[model samples]
Target: MQFDRKDKNDATLLDLYTQLLYPRMVEEKMLILLRQGRIGKWFSGIGQEAIAVGSALAMKETEYILPMHRNLGVFTARDIPLKKLMAQWQGKISGFTKGRDRSFHFGTQEYKIIGMISHLGPQMAIADGIALADLIADKKQATLVFTGEGATSEGDFHEAINVASVWNLPVIFLIENNGYGLSTPINEQFKCKDLVDRAAGYGIEGVQIDGNNILEVYDTLSDLAEKMRKDPKPVLVECLTFRMRGHEEASGTKYVPQELFDLWAQKDPVKCFEEYLLEQRILTPESIAEIKADFKAGIEQEVEAAFLEEEPVADTATEMQDMYAPHPYQPVEPNQQSAEIRYIDAITDALKIGMQKHNNLVLMGQDIAEYGGAFKITDGFVDLFGKARVRNTPICESAIVGAGLGLSINGYKAVVEMQFADFVTCGFNQIVNNLAKTHYRWGEKADVVVRMPTGAGTGAGPFHSQSNEAWFTKTPGLKIVYPAFPFDAKGLLLSAIEDPNPVLFFEHKYLYRSLSGQVPIGEYTLEIGKANLIKEGEQLSIITYGLGVHWALSYLDEHPEINATLLDLRSLQPWDKEAVAAAVKKTGRVLILHEDTLSSGFGAELSAWIAEHCFEQLDAPVMRCASSDTAIPMSKVLEESFLAKSRLKESIDKLMAY
Candidate 1:
């Protein structure tokens, strides 16, 4: 396909005008819905219709689009039914979410339109991933991501653009420079003279277009989209537009400058484009009026249809659904076999076995390929499995995880490795908002396992030495697992790989080589949500997971008089409440321990659950042992002082005394 720099002939001006006007009516109708209490709050793309409509028209239906919250125009242009969009806003079954997603968060697989994530900038990284999938699938489709100019300042935008440029992915990043981000002007948010110029730093072509000029937008985007599909290089286009209304229906424009608002209103894309069409003799005054009337009528019809539409009955049931695709719940046999194996080797063995069994599985991370990964967990596998299966990615965390989500969406099992658990924050948005909720919102499954080397006590400073499992455990729909011994690591990891949901598998860096335990030689799997009883006692129940279980067991061994039951919660989500209740009932005491900080830690949740369910059996108040609320220090002495260990035994002893 040849890239065209010129606009379509004047003959298509009427169609362009009609397309441009449709989104405006949609926006107005949505505002009405909001005012009448038919829909919740909405972010409007009033003055920026041209950029959304024109760019959308530039691409073919097969091309993918990842829109932002304010891109209702783009959604309309892509043929998403107005009633469905309204239903989504109204939290009804007729909506794309089936009544679960937040307002403006709607997706359609058939339309090739990924939903708009409320997060500001992470969609750019996701767009790059989708583009990468297209490349791998050998599909001739370009991926377009839309974001506000303010989103350009986010770390994700920088990371995604850099990776996209380096990989030369077929992605077109369209920044709707709508003058202000919420209330702050773009000038105060970014140092660059133009948002597009920032793209140059990533070694990608950058262009700025008149956002109100539909012809210019269509011409530039169509050209770039085609060029990207053919040559496959990232391009950044900044659309200088205006936000005619407040950020959302709830916000007011009392803070905005009246003069600037007036100037932008004069340059409204709809009015400006109509005049331009008339000047070119493509649209007469009567034709323009007729087009506007027709669009308004169409929008009203859509609204009426949406109001009368029957919401899907299945939407209510979908909310309580599990992450598993095709099926929700299936009981599995627990791990029973026991044999000695190394922790790190167990991880490698699980990956090898899972990959050999499941051809759809693909593993990628920095130094993971021939380098065998930083911890050598993926050693000797790239050569045997080939680069396609065991791939090495750039040191871009956001891009790596985002691409992993995209790959998972395209029917590939992705095992993404983060060198250290602390660094996973770089891709937090991808994990929390995208991968974690894909199944919950879009009714699609993401069987991606994110493996990270976590925990401190290894003299690696604050940045390198930290346990962030708690950070991810708080997110919904993500299964968090931390294994102390080798056998559980293998079994739990195998289960995570097979489970059709996103899993955060935290491998303690210190325990990988230091800890040794029995792991079965053959294929074995552990139930995701079930906890194990390491020791059965009567005095107290120490609820812990990962390395904490080891410490608790060690304490139990030392104090023969102290009969404390230890529970290792392998899976954080869908936790074993029954086992916990049973342990508390038998022991009549509860103590929660973890390596994370005390404030809002995983231990708090466990304590709360125990209190809510097993309060009657408690002999004394439930106590929690956790690290101090501070960044993990670099000094070994300080790190040791910060972590919770034998002090927990003291707390237990004190509780026993109480």
Candidate 2:
């Protein structure tokens, strides 16, 4: 062997041993805290330290790593001080997230480490996108993203790998197959003979290695990282290991068989490496005793000191700012009244204005680069900004959103497009669970705008056309915007881009090219949670948004005698409740209209709120005009007849009579 393992002073072997020892000590200390009730819980990396250390050591100090909860050993290897980790786990104010987050849910970008979400698979796509960002900047670096055997079953895992392969992203998928998925054995979960074999399906390299062998893992990954840096290719390496302890501090090994646990105990990675060091005569008994004593003393002192840190105080004054983005409706530049521009053109101009204003802006979507997006709303954008800024991604909505999240967190504001509004279903987890909760969880800025080309009136079938704005309104931390006019679309989109939190910008497909108004070409922004009363009247108020606003306007113009108030609710979430309340209070009759299915549409929420607050003032019942809860038809006739204009007019007449 080139490097003699028999030698007492082998630098690589000694370094590897030291790197793997930190997590073991931390794990042991965490259990002590748990027993004393100082710490609530901890996910032990008892048997997987070699996997964590080896994978993290594959990269340089400048490179980034997105670690799973079990990959605690990397923090010590990468030089994030043990004191900070203790403080974070103890939920102290000195923690990375200021005690707002718990367990492995906190990270520091200065150390080039990203913490894991409870849903671990989503970070794979996020890491891939981070790699793309570095690749675009010519960083010549590879990102290490970790996951377990169970996460491979997630659609996010498959989608991320496929997209990375398609783009040839420089990322390493380090899979620690611990022979169980939280007590469900691998045999019951996966049918494949070897999980590594699935790598060929994506046209990438795959290998299985001895996860318990510290020297073997470190040497293998060191070479692989060099090769990947030279040539960007995604690789999946599955490590065969076994969990020595239960899934977490709360979970026990009751489900694990006695024989299996005993079998893995013999091959415990830490003990095996320790025995190797002893056999090689790397240190005398006195030296080994000194190292052990040092680790034990430091663990106790650091943990005790961490307890002295104060708990984070609740800052209710910033609660409103933390939950949503800054509503920067105060415009800096003035605008002149220009002739009508297409809705699609207005969206493109808004993006241009945003990118010109802010240097750290990126765009991601499928067929967005050369094809100018599916709708060509981004036509000629790549030429203006280059391929690096305007990215053409794979047909993985989850990856696009996840990557946007990674970019947004790392100082760059991102705008991700869902080619079709219905396809947002593919990325719902990233949107609803991950993106929506960032600000609420740790006060992290989810500064990304998801442009959803929504609504149906073009005879497109159900799969391509959908009004999903109502679905996300249920989430607290998200801001939803659906613009009715080209003017609102331009202004609100710029505001969405500049906001500090995630914004869902829904642009109606029916209005993309067909709808136009006297929109200004310069930069201006409308308030996020405000509504415009297009027409005021004494009889009743027709509260509508998007296409409903236009339809109601046409009907109201034809019947001036009706004398109704029409409101354009551009901002869907955090809606203009004060304006709505006053209008409903004055008229005493309310008709909520939308193009979504009548039941549980966003209008239902509006009606429910009105009933709760303004019921006594209302003269009659709150009525809704919308389509039936049926799949959209392909035929134009059926679609039009099904989405009837007469319904809105008739609903209005009946409400007036009542």
Candidate 3:
């Protein structure tokens, strides 16, 4: 139980004990708060406090820590204000998210701690991104990510670890195996007895230790952290602990037998560690009682302070803060000559322009280099940009996006191709948690662009025939752009590549070859967030984007009497709220349309915004035109009926009647 290292002195042990006890008291207080209805439900890290505190102590404050939901212990140990922590539990504006986020979804970049992404298994990938950023900065700081045994089942965990091993990233994957993943026990979750064994598959070193032993956890983590600092490779440490409480405060022990609970109770990690401390003559019973009493009083005082704190007023201007860096939008010159161009050619030209302007630019995806990408958008890019700049990766979506994040932090303008937009779901964690929140969390920009071929009506069917722009639109910090014409495609793409934030550039597969438009011959970039008025009218505003804009334009050509204003929102985030509001006010009628599902679709956001801001200007109720909630079918007849055009025409007719 004792350490031989010189650093492991009495002072270190006292610090470790203090670290362990504080989080324990916080977790206990949170459970009581939940019962009293003062705070929301919580995920407790009761018995596993030793592992959380110990591993956190081993890491320097300069190093980044990406914690999972159960790492409240580590957050407390890292000096995250106890009052703020309690405020987060109470769902108050004083919390990290200002009451926008749920309990356990807290974070502070000031502490060098990346926020805990609520997703079950993306923390490992995010850790890789932080480490990559550190490496790019030429700093020695490392990244440590905490997860549970259950998360190992996710493909992102393996994909992230594998890439980290291949690149020798300075990251430590700390798996807190508390025997159960919610309800499924570790024994039933995986065939292997030890989760660390899986690390061998990725050609990485793996270790297992007694998570209950604070000293043991500290020694192992400190040793690995030192190794990571020097060699800079990914390591997995499976800390075998036990869940002393239910998964969450709301989860009862109905499935867990009473006998098994009694058996595990005797070996409770907190109690066992306390006994060890007593047996080693490290402390007396009276001293332990005094420590507990002090912790309780401290927590009570922090809770009182948090409850007395005033809530932050919701600011409308703050919404525009992290959307993109503060750069004045420059309009393309009116004299710029236009020429007919192909969609793929436009993409290639945009990449070339982006790379020439930004020396830190990097393009990556499966078959993107020599193979020229699945759609030939990157054809000859490797030869033109060199292998270092344009690289082809293996068919691992999670790894591809995860590594892209890493490279971006190193000062690279990364343009990652998802092959097809449908495949983006595979790397959803990297897109949503890491890329989307990078700017919002740290105020540091990640100039990364994700290019994916989207939309149905191309016979791609179910998996391949999805329009996923709605997904990214729902997520904050990401600028979603879907260009219908080749000109906007090139111009908007160049803007996305140049911008100092994440952009989800969606391309319609059908429009790549089927549609042709005039694009400027020379270098010119278009501003994102500006809506293009294809046709100005006063009868009704036909608000739409992407391919839907083409449909609205065509419909406008036939129905000139309707005098509908066709608004093409080139960017979904930081969308032209001003233009939309003005158009809605002038028209006195509005029709929101998109090619996404009707329920919880991107149109809902547009409708909600208009209803809140331009409600008084409306002459009629706001109308929505979107695809049905059913999945995209293979039949052309079914697709035509379910797509945006049919819905657009019908909704427009109804709006005119009103």
Candidate 4:
């Protein structure tokens, strides 16, 4: 019951007790505010305060901690200003997320804390990325990530732990076995005897402790953290505890047995720790009373001041500022004199140039390090960049993508490749929720380029041959790039890497080997959100991107007298609106084309925009040519019919005649 470390004197014990008491008092006050409707809601960590406070105190000052919604003590233990904390919870302008999000959904780099996303599982993989940075830099710092026993069933938890173990990253997977997840008990969540037992499957050490015992939790994690710093390896520590309140205030605790609360009240973390301090003579009754009274007063004053501060206004003027890190677009000068190369080689050349130019640039994917990826785009990159920068990850899309976000958080540029573009579904949550939302939510840069080799070809069938660009185009925080030529592929990839946003670079697998064009070697970047006018004319405008551009060019070559404008839109999200408007104004008719399915495709958005804005200038209704609404087939003949490239020529003729 007593921590008798000679080095950690009576003063250290008293300080730990103070740290534990602060969040308890803060939660008590916040609960009152919640009842009064002064704040929206709170995820109270009243009885389980010891796990957060003890583990946070055990960590070195510079180390990072990823805390779940219930771990408010982690923030208070690190001494994040109570004023700002209250503002964040109250949705005030002075909060860390600037009132964009609320209730521990934000993180601050100044305190080395990465806040948890609502998914409850992706943060584990993100912690691997933070620890991977330390491993690469040879830093003696370990990261601690908190999770609930219920979340262990999430695939990200398994993927993250497997990756950390394989890479020997210094991470502490802290699982708080809080007895229930929402209303479901432990038995319904998993079949294992204890959650820590699952760690053995990951080939890592596992430990379980009484989560309510502040002295035990602190000592166990402190020793483990020290060992990890010296010899980096992951460890799973399961802390047995109970959630004393409802999942949220509105959820209520009626489902929890009153007898269970009665039993847990006798072993409340705060009361037991306070009792321990008094019994050990670390502090007298008067000092404990003063500490509690002072903490209560501090919480009250800070909350009142936070309420007095200005609330966030919905201003459209500054709304777009932080959506992406500032990187001005630079126009590309087409270098015809450069040597000819295949599209895949151009991508290879760009990645080579990127690694050489940016010292902190890293590549992560399955089999990328030694096997050079499935497409062999990074054939010899492992030799040039070494294993530290070129990482081969497990077949866990969610974890690797989240790790890339983590690296970006730690001030590095990462390029994460999906072995096949279709495989991106496995990691979709990290992309749409974590990576895409990071900057807009908490002002965290997601400087990552997700290389997606997309499109239907090579008889690869539905799974591997998907033109999935439309999937991410609808997500706001992402930038989509789909180039049609070798020169553009090399230039735009370099540009995507330089842009401080989450860019989905979709490379057409069909064009990799089949298409060859003059590419300027070495470092060059093309402007994103700009369309390249391949050939300009006045009769009709053929608006397309990716493989559709190639199809349009071939048709135009055969019919030289059509007098049509061909626009290859490289960026899908910020498609060249000015260029599109100009093309629509110059040519009275428009034909939208793409390789993706016709329904809800990117072309639908373009066609609707053209119909809405250029209705007055139009000579006829906007036409569209795309694949039919069916999965890409394996047979080459079926795929060609599905793609309907022949329809592009017919659509052009109809638009021209109109």
Write the residue-wise lDDT of candidate 2 on 189-250 in tens digits: 78998888889999999988888887667767777778888998999989988887888868
Per-residue alpha-carbon lDDT of model 1 for 486-565, expressed as tens digits?
Answer: 98898889888888888899898888888887777766788778899888988888989888887888888888998778
Off by over 4 Å in 1: 1-12, 30-42, 99-102, 249-267, 276-290, 309-339, 386-396, 559-564, 597-600, 620-642, 655-658
By TM-score, who's the top model here?
A: 4
Clashing pairs in 4: none
lDDT of 4 by residue, 561-600 (tens): 8888889999997789889988888888888999999999
Poorest 10 consecutive residues of model 2 by lDDT? 1-10
> Cα deviation in Å at residue 513, candidate 3?
4.5
Q: How many pairs in model 3 have backbone atoms within 3 A of each other, for residues 3 or more apart or on separate chains, i.e. clashes?
A: 0
What do the candidate models score in CA lDDT, each in turn?
A: 0.81, 0.84, 0.79, 0.90
User: In what order do the candidates fall by TM-score, top score first?
Assistant: 4, 2, 1, 3
**How much is the lDDT of residue 309 in candidate 3?**
78
**Which regions of candidate 4 fall more than 4 Å away from where they truly are?**
1-7, 330-337
At residue 300, candidate 2 shows an lDDT of 84
Cα displacement (Å) at residue 18, model 2? 2.8
